[model samples]
Target: MQPLVVLISTFTLIFVASYASLQPAETYWNSVLPNTPMPKTIQDRLMSGSVHDWGVSKIHPDICAFYIFFPLCIGSNIKAKDDPRRYIFLTESDLKLGTKKNLYLMKSSNNANFLPQKVDDLDASTSKNLTVAINLLLSHPTSAEAKDMRNTIDMCEAGEDNACATTLEAMLDFTTSRLGNNIDTLISEGDTEVKIQSYSISDLKIMKSKKSIVCHKLTYPYAVYKCHSMSDTRAYKVSMVNANGKKINVGVVCHIDTSRWSPKHLAFEVLNVKPGTIPVCHLVPGDSIAWVPNEL
Candidate 1:
């Protein structure tokens, strides 16, 4: 009887161990891993939820190589170097092109930097069509339609509402003529400039004063140091201090425009300065430079 009881216990243990071993292990998701290079399709679905789907799935392998892989290969990469803003922009560009999987990868990565607000800006129902357009723009940045779209953004930034509106109308007209349907207009007149109020950074209290913060002139997109308001610590306004104790006035901090394919700091071009004199300006606060809640 004792021998039989021992035999039964042994069998039960074996069965339980075997069943546990057969179960799948928890999947670990890493967004930066480089594997599974195939473009999105039905067959590629098998590679889903794998660690190897990171760098391999990017639309622009060349850009990804430069921005993501090269640094790691050479061992000169900055730790946690992924820029959420760039990723969001590039991902949106991909979604605009019809790369559904790329968008899904981004959404699934659960990166804090991913901008859901920007994604929500698109029409939810027409995701596939929007992705198609985005893909086209990504492949051919110099395309006439892409150029027009860029110009429209620029015009809107320059306060040319009529011109911007006309360009948007043209885009809608072109899409309607070609596809026999109109796309949800992502860019409109009212969505242009969003003003953020002044706020505190660390221990420093900022207040929006009489001075309007002006965007520094740069060859690429950069952040402008707008003054923060003291009262609420959330209000920000654009301003600039000039030489000869004169305050040079520029318009409100409307839009952040970038000409480069990557992130950079905002810089100023000093005019009317003495040959040996250097003008001084406040650098963007560390907290300010980092991601802030997109209330604006």
Candidate 2:
């Protein structure tokens, strides 16, 4: 009986080893290989950074505990209110009701001076549709402009992840945009070092009118307080994973007015994140508060 058991175990071991040995190197490596290289146009924009002179020099530490993200005011060209650049952040409605000629995606800058002093340029002429625009960006990534953008993003990535204002912004832009744009392909980009996972707002109840949401502003003031909660809010969950695979779950709420917008739901104000458990942002009691979109 003992000899029979030993023979059976030996056979099992041999079978396992044989199967593994027969596996093709490409097939084995493919499981761990990064997603196919992204097109250049999209890569360029993803690497792009905006020069943020407003609050680049400094940041607060207390707010680093919460996972809240405030809506940022952004435009292609900073036109005066009389010319208001049409809008700040791009929305789906803009695609149907407007065009990308005047739209500019918002990004943050972090200069190692503990401030962000440079901006990365983007060529918006890639495509008209958002999905196609992303694909086109992925396709053509070989120009000097693309190089410059990569330089900026790479600099920040190498810098302190949370300390540099631009690095933080760069992280936010890449995470949010990619997560929002394409989840499966989001983490496939080889350049970024952070790992992430997300939960959509489809089944989650993320909005409330009477509640006062909490957050920490990023710029000079680094305002920490409870923000006014609007009646209409669209949000989802994002898990910023670390090298060890631990997740920091964050509750992000966006103020999107779809009633009178270009797309069914256009996000003028991108999001108001709750400081649930993000390493960068923290929640604290406060006397000062502001409406993020209004601030934008």
Candidate 3:
């Protein structure tokens, strides 16, 4: 009994020491946090949870990757007034054209980094606070404690830059908590080996349904995402063939519940509908991620 008690004490001390010593890599902030300040107009809209006129060019590799994987997503070049899919559209293109190789290049470069890193295994390129927060959130805080954490996250989302890291971590934790011990981060890459294991492009329409978090890459220095999950969300895995004949399996999340979404969301403007009137679906872009529960 004395030995067991000593072991427990040692473990607690080690955990506390490690937790207190955690720090982000010197370059983590430079790579993940935004360098140039976001335009006040765009920032204001984001704070209010409205993505209307995001203004950031989708041609940027990170943003462009979404179009490559989720070709159904309305392109930045398309005017909101011209979009025809104002409601839910589940159609998957068998042959995706017009996507550039630069989008693929960006995904290949950053795919590994987009994954959630463990607190003890983190490197200089990852956000330490975010890692720690996820670990804590997953540890089963009281309901009031969780609510307070979410409030802090809301403050962060409302432009409190100091709280952004914590906000992201908490969001990730909540998103992932939907699953048990079965989370997997999927990044689409066009490779022969992957193609062999992927679904035929035609089979995309019939794939089994699942739940997942479609994490969109937000404009940040290293890597930050607006990761969210909805009850009515359906994420599907489907194969897509690009113009170059490269095949890859990608995740597409369709949100059937937009009732709580801000009416001014970009989807509403692009789809020409008011919030909650109908479902909105989009692809899981190459630069982004789909966190799903792995099927046993």
The predicted structure with the larger TM-score, 1 or 3, is 3
lDDT by residue for model 2 (1-296), tens: 00000111222232233212333323322343234233232223222222232232233232111212222122123223322112223222222211222221112221121111112111211112323322233344454333433332333233221212222233223333322322221111121232122212122222223222222222222121112223344333223333344333323333443343322111322322222211121112111111112110
RMSD of each: 25.1, 22.6, 16.0
Estimate every model's Cα lDDT from 0 to 1.
0.21, 0.25, 0.39
Using all chains and alpha carbons, the TM-scores for the candidates as numbered come to 0.17, 0.22, 0.42
Shift of residue 104 alpha carbon in model 1, Å:
35
Poorest stretch of ten by lDDT in candidate 3: 1-10
Residue 25 of model 2 has an lDDT of 28
Question: What is the per-residue lDDT of model 3 for residues 1-296, given as tens digits with 9 covering 90 to 100?
Answer: 00000111122333333221343332232243223222221122221111122221111232233422233332246544433222223323322333222112123223212212223123222222433443333344344334433433343354211112212333345544565434555444434332122233533432233566555544321234555553566566556655556665555666767788776565666556777776676545544556666552
Q: Candidate 2: lDDT of 235? A: 36
Model 1 clash tally, residue pairs: 30
Give the lDDT ranking, best first.
Answer: 3, 2, 1
Better of 2 and 3 by TM-score: 3
Q: Order the candidate numbers by TM-score, best to worst.
A: 3, 2, 1
